[model samples]
Target: MRFFRRLMLCVAPALLGVAASEPLSESFDVSVPQLPQIVATDGGKAVRYELHLTNFATVPLAVRGILVTDADTGKILRSFSRRPLLTHLIPLSGTRDDPSSARVTIQPGARAVLYVELSGPLPRRIGHTVDYVAACETCPLRLEIPAVAVNQAAAVTLAPPLAAGPWAAVQSPDWPRGHRRVVYTLDGKARIPGRYAIDWVGLDDAGRTTRGDPDRAVDAIGYDAPVLAGADARVAAVRDGMVESASIARNPDHVLGDGSGNYVALDLGQGRYAFYEHLRPGSIQVKVGQRVRRGQAIGALGFSGDTTGPHLHLHVANGLDPLKAEGIPFVIDSYTEIGRYDDIGALGSKPWQSAGPTRKSHEWPASNVVVRFR
Candidate 1:
């Protein structure tokens, strides 16, 4: 699959056939990869798609609302405003009231992602054509998407791609809707719909991250810690020598240019790939085209690339390129639930409550829940 930097806008010839000008005409563009038709676990017909929104103007654009409807019947299937039940089916970053209260802003030349879900047992007939309207302050845009044919093949089941180890989940999908950091991405492609992804960091008994010092990249815990291969795999890609961004306000060009700095991409057979990002400069031990086994050390964790601090950013996707692939769910072999923090901001000082049990089978650790490996 190819990655797109920006979407192209094509106006229907019927709309005066003239190229749309600034303000509403050519200010933004939207595209959907494919409309996946599937039967939800609830036995309802489901359609899941992600909208890639790009702003072409020089100033920021405030997105007021989004409305989706059946093009033939004009029946509104979902709206960010009226239908709370159906609209809630999609995992949007902000609250329901956000559209009118405080709309989402799209920075100049930046992109935004909106995952939408339409499901119900009643609508036995799926609409072949879907229409959507995007409400913004300066101009409103509408799109008519021709639904692609459905793929009847069964969904692929996923397995854990990591070794058993004590780790803390950060910006994880398991977190509360608004608090989930993985939902936001710089390129608008990292937030894959229906798939679980997470950022991990190591921790000690004192709640302090194992390695690095705050504000100082080198002093941070987990710095230079060994990064183990989650499963037997072939090195699909490797990148190194990218400079680290020490502060939260990173250089946009570097951050967006080389997202997974000094990293490794492992193809674990099938179509799944394990991505380990932000490794220490010159610390990568595996090269592209190399073969590795489960639990093998591939590299040392570092603060390299578009990171504010040192930590291991790992995710399993359907393809080798993380940002362009679909994120998939997986479980670690085994781990003990240690404790969880009440407030992540008070990381080093917060007292953790003892966890209840341990799991030996495949399962995802709860957000902010601490876990230890045997």
Candidate 2:
């Protein structure tokens, strides 16, 4: 009996099975919704859609693939899966999770969001569906998403304006801070896999100071905030479960360089991808092969990588490869023109934030305008 008991203990993991080889029966609560009107000029137009998936069981589960098809012809339109550049897993908390592992696990009652967009002339007709293979510790299962169409468009106005204020320069040693004189030119175009700016509630404020204060106001600001989808696209890469850093202060333990903490990369189609980095641990809200819409709630911001304070760092890149991708130029919808560090004309300017004062002299925008097309 003693020997049998020991053998059972040794075989427990095998009996329970590993995620890779096991199949389970899983139920999903899923939905598809039409998006608001999206305007474009010339030959460009925008169509938006969203997919929300929730796990109803207590055990962990995995979703392997999702596909979109045209309901009229039963022909496949777009395909999404666990690809290197087009798959992601988000937690119920709306945070991005890491995808390096073999399986995606969602706790009981957890939810994930998938936003999808098709740009260019609106399709004559469209329908969307998902293909998912999920498993628990002991069983594996497969699911086919209910087909839905992208036939409706709603009216939507531009977003609200940002706050206005005087631009105050914060000085940093190696990082670009306040303003400096540099000759730079904008790219004639923007590409997928691009990077952009993430404005923190407190860090990017025109009048706020993030340095050299005992109060550490910058540290006081929480790292987690809603991260909107920069562009319309299907869900791409998502990396979660990385531990969130407590503060941006230099830590000797971080010397080895772990890339952005938890992150989400969205494929804007046409070889363009947008990456949101330094996400809070376990805050992801989407899954692999899922679709996402622009300005949708994806995840919260956090300081998890090479950062000194809780500020969002956004830039555009060209390729899906994070290491090899090149940064691109992008414009926010709106921003105020505040005072400059070295320019007297910009001094005491109300409700503006200057990009810098050294290279070019420009005023920030006022608070009431939405940052559009920038």
Candidate 3:
């Protein structure tokens, strides 16, 4: 009888079909909204992009890790965890920020964005494996994003936006509320126009950002600095005749007109538009349909828009919509790396920490670094 029972157990799967199949439904819908773009950084190359995740399950799903890999070889490229992972995931809808709660969790039917920056040799395509656990479920789940194509389009190479330097190419390194993290959803589309933007904050001979105090707009070093054209192109758009504050405002809420104030947009050919923002009132020298030469003085930087002080906000985008266009990367033709800083206060404290004055070409200056553009 025991032998007969054993035989029945062995043949049960074939005779009565007792074998189980894994569930085919996914817990989350994963997509890459844009192709990851490649930039030639000082250290090899970096892929910059984002992933949009939407919860598919009825309950919440707490994201644990996101693993990026080479699509062809399946080789691991970059992985994120802990605090790094927490800060990168931004919930787009229906979630309150709680310090104690796991910030990576996406509620049912809610969506979140994961900003990813991976560095290495350029991959033909990238893949992703996202680990998460659903509420009211025992087992963890993984969502796979297979074969996202890398954007092969080369970064636009351009001349320096200013004729002089010892200028600080100020792109914030922080992920929290920096230009790189702002994903503006407007007109039914989402894009980050300042992903590669830099605030060209000029400095004086004594290595000071301001001559007197930061409160006075004219005292700021970046004020009245000539905003130069990065390319020989047509003046696509210009916003002029905006009033400026005599004193600097400290982190005030941004309101009024696209937050750019008086500005000039250059059509740099190939559908790329270069923007120079926050010009001094009545300083914009060019108008729409005018031709501009490379290094031409288009305007002067000032505190005309939402700003902590006077500075030129320069960026290249795919469209004319400053808020809705996807920001693209560009490299200055030549510049000397002076050093870096954590904040504006760190500059001129002790000679910029010395980057050895090495001339770098066809490379974008890193965040908060001092550079003398040639």
**Candidate 3 residue-wise lDDT, 1-374, digit = tens:** 00000112122344556674333334667767667788776646776788888876687778878888898999998776666677777788746446454448888889888888877686888887887776535566666666788888889888888866788877763556778888888889778888889988878756678878767889887788888888889999999887887767654555745488789999988889988998999998988999999998999988887877788898889999678799998888888887777565767444565666777888877878888866
TM-score of each: 0.59, 0.39, 0.89
Best lDDT among the predictions, by candidate number: 3
Better of 1 and 3 by TM-score: 3
lDDT of 1 at 277: 87
The global Cα lDDT (0 to 1) of model 1 is 0.57
Query: Which digits, one per residue and each the tens of the lDDT, describe model 1 over residues 73-169?
Result: 5576766543432233233333233433434556667766555556563242223221222333433544444433444434333233233445666
- 2 versus 3: better TM-score goes to: 3
Q: Spell out the clash pairs found in candidate 3.
A: none
Q: Write down the worst ten-residue block by lDDT for model 1.
A: 124-133
TM-score of 2: 0.39
Runs of candidate 1 with Cα error greater than 4 angstroms are 1-166, 173-195, 210-213, 243-255
Name the candidate that leads on TM-score: 3
